[model samples]
Target: MASVFNAVDSISAELATIIQLEAPDEISVTKKDAKIEELMVMDQSLLQCMGVSHASIESILRTTLKYKLAFKLTGARGGGSVLTLLQTLLSATVVDKVTAELESCGFHCLTATIGGQGVQVCFGGSS
Candidate 1:
């Protein structure tokens, strides 16, 4: 939740800065939209620092295809992976082949699942 708030706040600040630099006009709206896009790119770059595994997956996607990819922290537990948006239409086979190639190159991949086991709780009086 904090991260979501942070991203929104940062984007708001950026839009403000862009608006302040321009006169009130349609061009100002365009400029603010551009700044939002820029913020998305910066957020992707920040994802690179999320840890080695995350970085590796992001690298794989970038190397495999030309797509608008963004990595976001998803779910209440703050977990997620690279979210791909198509710039151009791609065949499903291409995605499958890329996944296979990544696996062959030794990156583990998993489907997103929900409601998994949680940490076991032993309710004996604390020491």
Candidate 2:
């Protein structure tokens, strides 16, 4: 269990680094850590609602821990037009990169957009 938490932390750090590297200089990225209690509330019905398959849901449930890492983007310094365009491109790139990294680690990830400038990535499975 402790190891699971450590792995989650490591993955989160790597993801942060990836985002920082990919994001433009004018974009500010903030990371929010999800509570385990929040993760625990995710049940089969909820996953099903998210369009997860039965098999995948079962596998997800069996995992002892789940994690969510949110990346919020705000323009630090940019014109309105340039900021909007940069945010749009960064959002897509972050999602694709994060999804690939998590899936390669055997975790199932769900991405949701937030406030038109942020992405919340929820993931769980065996480490």
Candidate 3:
């Protein structure tokens, strides 16, 4: 499923961040960036082989972190299910901004989170 591909993308992004933090020199940073790009491309190819369209896969792989989080909250289909409902309870302002962005891109952006004190909606009607 797309979730598996998404997980690979997440792991790759986290690894890139870790590498950037720990890299000692410009050469190391360049190498790390190349490796990350290669891995991401391969992951996207695998997703395409598994039936996801190029557009959907690209949107999933190339978007900002907030968009990725929004995808997770809204589900790949962008439907607001019980899981999405629970996630919205712990929302953030970035989620609101990205939700709008995702919507403009034709994906549904739900109000949600991975969990906690629930959403306070301090930043407008982000919830």
Candidate 4:
């Protein structure tokens, strides 16, 4: 939640600049309130196993493909093992980016390790 809030604040700031430049006093700040509400709608779509698998961490890379930031993972695949779809790699990147984002939002991500069970996530935040 803190991550989301922080993202909202940052994005809203950027958008506010654009809005003001385009419309000036023509519109009110009420427009941003809708965006704030939209960001609060959490995207909880996922499965338990995929959350921890190394193969699932490349979601960010997959997103890059769609956005033509395909430029990021430049060059071609040669030798060694075959490449996997961008989707399979997205999970880890998502976790990493979200962790940093949440951290930047003033939240501490509590990670607990369990024998044979793996790392469990404990979500907590401070405003």
Candidate 5:
């Protein structure tokens, strides 16, 4: 053990890079107040009803998105405006039910890009 330690100590100090230590800058956002305000407006009533703790909900949010569920209750608005494409090698019946559910929640089921590509679902509504 003594010899091993000596050899390690004697090894040339010349190296591409030595051990690096750093104090990283703070990870922060300046405009979070506005965002938090917006989310509060979006579903403040529902959030109050569900009894969700502030700490847990804050953990899941970033600058762009927030997904929160507490006590088995998903929030008022689940998804947003986007294209959802499902590429199925074969046909099935249940897919219709799925689209119906989306529409009920207010999604516009647009063109089905068939055969060559996946099924494209475009979701949008004023509400």
Candidate 6:
């Protein structure tokens, strides 16, 4: 079990490095840990049901960190969500690809209204 955990951790770290390399220039990926709140947002049971491994979840968490940083740097007002900031700062194709990647990792991205705003991306569940 210990060896399995170590292997998973190693793979997660490698995936994080790849994600950092692929990230947009404006978003800087770091080795800092993700906040508990950010980690809690993901649905663990759903992820398990969708066959997402622990390594994948770790990668997603790292990606979420990058997204949060990008949101803050883009001058998000009144506590805007990361998805909203992404939509505003990135092209539609890029946003779609992000969502698609999330979907592949066992997350579902929904279009929802927030604070009377017409459309926003909500990541949860599985699809």
lDDT of all predictions, in order shown? 0.52, 0.38, 0.48, 0.35, 0.34, 0.42
Please give each candidate's TM-score.
0.35, 0.23, 0.33, 0.20, 0.25, 0.30
Give one digit per residue, the lDDT tens place, for model 2 in 12-122: 565455444533333323212122122223322343444534453344343322322222212234411100111332456555665565467576555444334466666
Off by over 4 Å in 1: 1-40, 48-58, 65-81, 85-89, 111-127
lDDT of 1 by residue, 32-118 (tens): 545555665565555444442455555665645443333332233355444433222336666676667767878655544222355
Which tens-of-lDDT digit does each residue in 25-104 have in candidate 3?
Answer: 66765565555545545554554566555455346445544343322221245523211221222347655665566567
User: How big is the positional error of residue 122 in model 4, measured in Å on the Cα after superposition?
Assistant: 28
Would you list the clashing residue pairs of candidate 1? none
Candidates' RMSD to native = 13.3, 17.8, 11.2, 19.0, 22.3, 15.2
Could you tell me which 10 consecutive residues in candidate 4 have the lowest summed lDDT?
A: 40-49
Q: Which candidate has the highest lDDT of all?
A: 1
The residue-level lDDT of candidate 3 at 26 comes to 68
Please give the TM-score that candidate 3 achieves against the real structure. 0.33
TM-score: model 2 vs. ground truth: 0.23
Of the candidates numbered 1 and 2, which has the greater lDDT value?
1
- Which pairs clash (backbone N, Cα, C closer than 3 Å) in model 3? 87-112, 87-113, 88-111, 88-112, 89-118, 89-119
Q: Which stretches of candidate 4 lie over 4 Å from their true place?
A: 1-90, 113-127
Worst 10 residues of 6 by lDDT: 71-80
Please estimate how well model 4 matches the true structure, expressed as its whole-model Cα lDDT: 0.35
Write the residue-wise lDDT of candidate 6 on 1-127 in tens digits.
Answer: 5654465456456545543443233333222223212322332323344454456445655665555522111112432123322422345666676677767877655654323434667779533
Pairs that clash in candidate 2:
none
Model 5 is weakest, by summed lDDT over 10 consecutive residues, at: 14-23
By lDDT, the candidates rank as 1, 3, 6, 2, 4, 5
The model with the greater lDDT, 1 or 4, is 1
